[model samples]
Target: MGIRSTLPLCAVVAGTAALQIPLLSPHQQAPLEAADKTKPLINSSALQDLISGDRLFTRAKKLFDIAKLGEDEYNHPTRVIGSAGHEGTLAYIYESILQLGDYYKLDNQSFPAVSGNVFESRLVIGNSVSKSAAPMGLTPPTQNKQPVHGDLVLVENEGCQIGDFPDSVSGNIAFIKRGTCPFGTKSEHAGQKGATAAIVYNYEKDAVQGTLGTPSPNHVATFGLSGKEAGPVLEKLEKKDKVDAIAYIDADVKQIITRNIIAQTSEGDPNNCVMLGAHSDSVAEGPGINDDGSGSISLLEVATQLTKFNVSNCVRFAWWAGEEEGLLGSDYYVATLPEEENIKIRLFMDYDMMASPNFAYQIYNATNAVNPNGSEELRDLYIDWYKDQGLNYTFIPFDGRSDYDGFIRGGIPGGGIATGAEGIKTKEEEKQFGGKAGEWYDHCYHQLCDDLSNVNMTAWIVNTKLIAHSVGTYARSFKGFPKRTSSVASSAYESEAKYHGSMLYI
Candidate 1:
């Protein structure tokens, strides 16, 4: 959850200045040139092998089509490591990987996967107190459902500062902002100040409108409130007025065990690795088929197929558990890695939601601001592949919204493909894509309706095949990475925006 990589790549400048500026010094340029010259290039044999990998697709479809998985099955819930849902999902994935590994002769290892979960809490507003609200993921579960009523402490900035909480906040719930610093930090600070609970309001600058923050590690319950709702409470707190509010942060959530499924090629060395990962967990409320079932199936097929094929790159596959509960499995895996193992990861391809009936395929471009992620060479290679395939995609910045966040933060090159979700398509995009501009890309994105029946098989299958082909291409002949381009300012974004129109939150 903390920031991952400390390695600094060159920052990208824009327009005229960037064009005139040289990125490397004379000495660095020579090494870079020499490295590029010695790198391998993709060969036709690998492409043929990838194209012929039908067994992988068959297996992937089987898992994706099956909807029996609950949060702990193919789809994980909010449970992190040690939760039944988390553990169950992990166990299933682990079994799948073991099967694939044994069949393919790949050396696979299982490590401890763990996460924090809150089991209890108490909220008291005025005279009424009840444990009706459960803290969100990464927030601590309430220690006691004890009713604690006092003046509500509203911290204006997302970061808890000196004046944010007064002494009156003792035995009170502190409301904090969700920008400037991580929500977890602010919540932890409030808890250190003897605050009973924390409510994080979404930052005004955030495009995603919601009051969101991490839970307290010290078992402090945290709630996310909208800016509209938190504003008045903050105003009252600033006035030093006594306020009555109900606070209950308790849940039946319990600790349990979980596992991560992994499969690798027998011929490859673990020292140099290529990882492809996707979480098999879903939100607790729904089946989360498209949210990840699509991705799971895609990777399953890819991994299964890899077991049968012979490739030069050491490829590994992972089906993570507890992704719904704040990336527990992936986080644990990344955190436990030795420095060398972490750096040996040449690329990490994350497939979250690959097939959506409503949205066109959208690739997570590492060059996007949300990610500004991975090695430049990795992104360029993938981008070039997309172009060659004539696939339609929109590049967004890296925001650590998925499992790939861990690898990306660690400075590994990461890129994945996703189809549209809730975002509206622009007019220009509509012209290109020919869909209703302001409709949800996948109406069943996170609901039970997201079963296999809701997915567009053509899209799913095509995209899955594309992923296999792309990965194989990279595995066969990757050399030095491509030049990094930071802060890609696209002239086409406006045109695309005009076509898609504004997002409609239905």
Candidate 2:
């Protein structure tokens, strides 16, 4: 996921004139700072103007209505994870953005039609022999669709280093423990070891719910197993007894279509454009309401709110497809953008899973605990925005785990906010967030139960408001998301020196 692209810093600095932004010192409130000296913050007249004008909540409702396009009579859409059903959802999202573009009079960019291949398998593993097995994602269909058996060699660390399994791994299938790397990496390594098949076990003590990577067309098949289901098999292997396993994967490789529906606010100063984005597609099992419906809805609301604003800089919104499939849409979008085009991107804010049924706001690890994947400036900006709104949160590293992966790789300063996912709530977090210690932030995460009814409307509304505020503020704030500063207040005057006039249009 590492971005190989570079920004044209020298060219940008050399060609653009600097613009000044009004300062809001440490004592100034963000809301107060937003009001011009002549305008009253709560003036009945201004309130009336805005109320009659485009309001965020009004726009939110309109967007909510659009999101209901594919829903059932009960307003509950069965947006199956990774199925053809998503096409209807995608069409709904596309038409919504197109309408926003028409409303805003913006030159919305159209993403090229997506062309890829996918194979969905309905796997049923019978415990006839009582050995653990589950199909992995992106796995290729079997040549004969016949079952294979072999002694399970418990490979440690899942690294699959040549030295890790020095003995001949040919013919015999390899059973690997998941960890130290991605499931895909482990599967690919097992294929290299001449493994006829691969069975990956859970790295955790409890359940092994990790995703398996797609296997190469020429490589052996791969499967994953829960810890409980795999323990006895491991026990037998430890006793030097041969383990028997059967894998039935209905894998097929066929071309698939995906897309990134993009809508931009009217072009203003090019160099200062801000991007707001969220993926629209979910895994092939559930209606990704929390996984991304939250973010997508927020973007729709923001797009509607900004529809009439005479912004200093342009704002763009994107509803990406294939994010759950390793961020394919975003990555393809970034990779295809020209160099000058890429540099014009001042900031990117991704809103993936912004709300959960159980709301414990999980900030992207901007602390860079795991990697330097976050923009320090963007992180601070987001954190400050949250603090001003009096929201509770935690900061983690970028993790290269979502659609932001593409933007971060491209060096376009970007950051995002996410409600918690599969991560367990610790005793400390439970005390702070008022959740059960043993429970996860979203129990129905990636499950069919993750529908709109389960969503915490209060948290959803607040998060949407915050996202709107951020996009609106950045649209009119100094140049773009700047590098993080200990005192964001101090950076106001320095804005004049920082703003690089608009970049050349693509």
Candidate 3:
């Protein structure tokens, strides 16, 4: 299927530095020779055998290195959308798949998106100027970078609902505690209440690096504060102490062009397609090796191996962009597909953040009321695979935080796997996964420290093997897989669409 878009291109906001790394170096191996048509159909064991942890780590390290090449004075090594690092990542995937000859049909689905980054932020409370202020991504900057001076009004009960923003918050700055809803929702509500700006403080001791999901007219200049930085301010407010502050965020928010890389096997039944995807872009804070680099590399490795054999169903792999800002690429892909093309996608599986340091084999729980009917079957496939391997697995909610959100809402059956991210581990999980309890599954999640060291090689390889098993099994046959139905639960779509990012649930 071809990519047809009516979206107009805009001026690029981020620089595209040329990738200095060679496409095929000594360490970067080429794709295996084309599959012999006479070869046997792909099997789970054979596919699983092709997954190598050493190879996975090598490729992941390559991606990290590419990210570092894009580093600038204003930003860290990151593959955030529209940056040079993400462009290099796109080139690597495209060139790698091209090496396999015409075995797969590649599509460059181009679209426009609003990319933003915070360069400088400040929160001044009297003479005490806190330069540690972190601006929420995609939120508009202070008008012309001028400081917004107003009384700091503490929002009641997390500021999730409109009523939580008191009338006094009008013509002032809303000091909100982070939790229960999206940062975008809080900012939107604050703007609705006529607040000039908003400050959201983390509930934990860690620094806050959050997103407003996407640009909105209702949003005001929003910033994040660490718990420690906001503690005294909160105490003073609680004691009815008069508090006035100046908030300023210098950010570059503008529209830019980005594309999604989609490749489908040329030899399989086009009418029956098995799809797999992962967001290829990282958050601005770091290289994002564990957050999604692991997932992206897993798909690349599996795609490379799949060329050795033929299949009964078309296998489509996608590397999505604009996922860090929100699930923009995937959402656009699903929305633009013709109804005929959409129905051909029998199943869509997502793999994201597969290598948390303190990992657990967590499969998406598709039994939730919001998910489509056939999603449960996909979940069972993963659960059975983990059981066969004698590995313990847990269920994470199939919420609309990732790329799968768009597919499920469009009535396609979707499911996938993840290790974990930012969520605290339980004692039972520690016993099962052999990791510390009461600690984050990924300690360096969305931080500059989320480099190669943050990955769990063992867990990553195991998860990659599972991906191979699922792809091979379904490619051979879909005898027990459910057929696509015409109708979807409307209420389900409404519920799922409300979620924008992973941090929203927290």
Judged by lDDT, which candidate is best? Answer: 3
Better of 2 and 3 by TM-score: 3
TM per candidate: 0.71, 0.72, 0.83
Give the per-residue lDDT of model 3 (tens digit) for 219-249: 9999888888888889999998989999888
lDDT of 2 by residue, 48-136 (tens): 23321123334334433444443552234434323444566666665655665333322222343222222332323324543445465
**Cα-based lDDT at residue 217, candidate 1:** 52
Error of 3 at 417 (Å): 0.6
Model 3's C-alpha root-mean-square deviation from the true structure amounts to 8.5
- Per-candidate RMSD vs. true structure? 10.4, 9.7, 8.5
Q: Model 3, stretches more than 4 Å misplaced?
A: 1-36, 73-75, 124-134, 154-171, 175-194, 200-210, 224-241, 489-498
How high is the lDDT of residue 251 in model 1? 48
lDDT order, best first, reads 3, 2, 1
**lDDT, residue 356, model 1:** 73
Scanning candidate 2 in windows of ten residues, the lowest lDDT window is: 497-506
